[model samples]
Target: MHLRQFNKAGVEAFRRFLEACRENPKEPVPVDLLESHEHTVLTSKQIVVEPREFSSRRQAADYFQDLLSPIPPDAVRKDAGIWTWLSLFYFDQICPTGNGNRKVRNDYTYIYMPDESRYFYRHLLFIAWQVKQVAPECNRLFLDSSLVTLDKLTTEVFKRLYLTRIPCLFELLDRLYWDCSNNRPAKGIVSPHKISAGDLVHRFPTRIRQLEKTYDLQSLDADQLLEILGDEFRQRAATSQSQMELSMQ
Candidate 1:
């Protein structure tokens, strides 16, 4: 289908639609919204989206990046309307029907709120697309996560405004948390128990920020970053490597 964006009225209508969905979580996507010219405006650059089941966020990001490549980055990067429309287009995958009903969340989760609000980055599709564009290498971190549920690792990392810009931080995370053997994140990276004391969700963000105050973190590579981490992180990294080695054997 050709790509279209919701106008102001369209966004308002979409919000109401979400509200209705919350009222009746099992309600199917309103097909009319897809074709309603009154609510949506055709973009100057028409791109087609062939919807399919995205196995992971990486696949979804890559699909969006390839499909939207022809359009100027600025046009789509900050375009709340297009992102919202895309979210609606892939509503099933992002917020799929489970058991008997869908679990719809806040409007910001489905709609792009570019107001620099804390929830601005929460939009499922847009954040995937954004991360793919800005930090393609870091895609490994989310390679196995569900497209529908936002995990703690994602929430904690992206919520920090500066974390995404520093490539080394992602590299460190990939080394410490990603399980290359199974092609998923290492287990318990976000666990809150004593076993996961230096976990990604709780310790990494604060430790990285502290590192920023003491070092020019932007200048450091992943190895250099690892060198400075506390013993907990290094121990975890060694364990991760050992696991990868064992899996390969």
Candidate 2:
């Protein structure tokens, strides 16, 4: 299998690791250290959660900010502005860094921006995965040019499916957007909103949930999920195209 992102599965797996950390708050979270050269082969225990997973969002945010602090400075002089921005955004969202009013959670006075907090959490998870999967090269590349590397890696992963004639995630997502757009007819013309990557990413949560309901996605693996998604995307695309043609007539 090609390099798979630690997206959903990685998120879940990291949560499991966190759950393990939460079990014992007093103890220093155990990490099985690997030699500097052996970073590519990953295990669940690489990250050592210190003190404990905090109860409050503020505490959690602070802890995470400290944990991820090393990464941003590395990316500072490099072209990894997104990496730095995302990191700063998480901590900054906890408290408004500027003159603008900050929104706080209803339950907690200082607690604000759960969404950014979660985004940062996912980033940490990605880092944890990279530490194991990419090895020493991860530190060098992830800070400066990880997105480009990841995009290339994603393309490489898709290329593998070409032998089996399978549509990759990018193709599936494109078809999904095309299939979902409402066609408007006015003055003998049709118009469809231009779907972008952001649009697709925004719609994905709802669409993926819908797909889960349609199939037993919980039981399926990544490859199986891709297969089902591709089939459904193609079907939707075909149906939409037919509908558009009929509407024109």
What are the models' TM-scores?
0.90, 0.23
| Residue 69 of model 2, lDDT score | 48
Write one digit per residue (lDDT tens) for candidate 2, span 1-249: 111112333333333433443454332222221111221222124334343433333344345445544444333222122222232223233223234433222211111122442232124223333232322221221222222112222222222322113223333333333332343211111112433322332233344556756776555544565565555445545665676577677
The candidate scoring highest on TM-score is 1
- TM-score for candidate 2: 0.23
lDDT tens digits by residue: candidate 1, 1-249: 788998998888889889998899877787688769898988754687777899888888889899889888877778999899888888888888888788899889998988765987788988888777767785677645678877777877788878777767777787898776777887787776544656887788778889899898889898898889889889888877887888888
Worst 10 residues of 2 by lDDT: 183-192
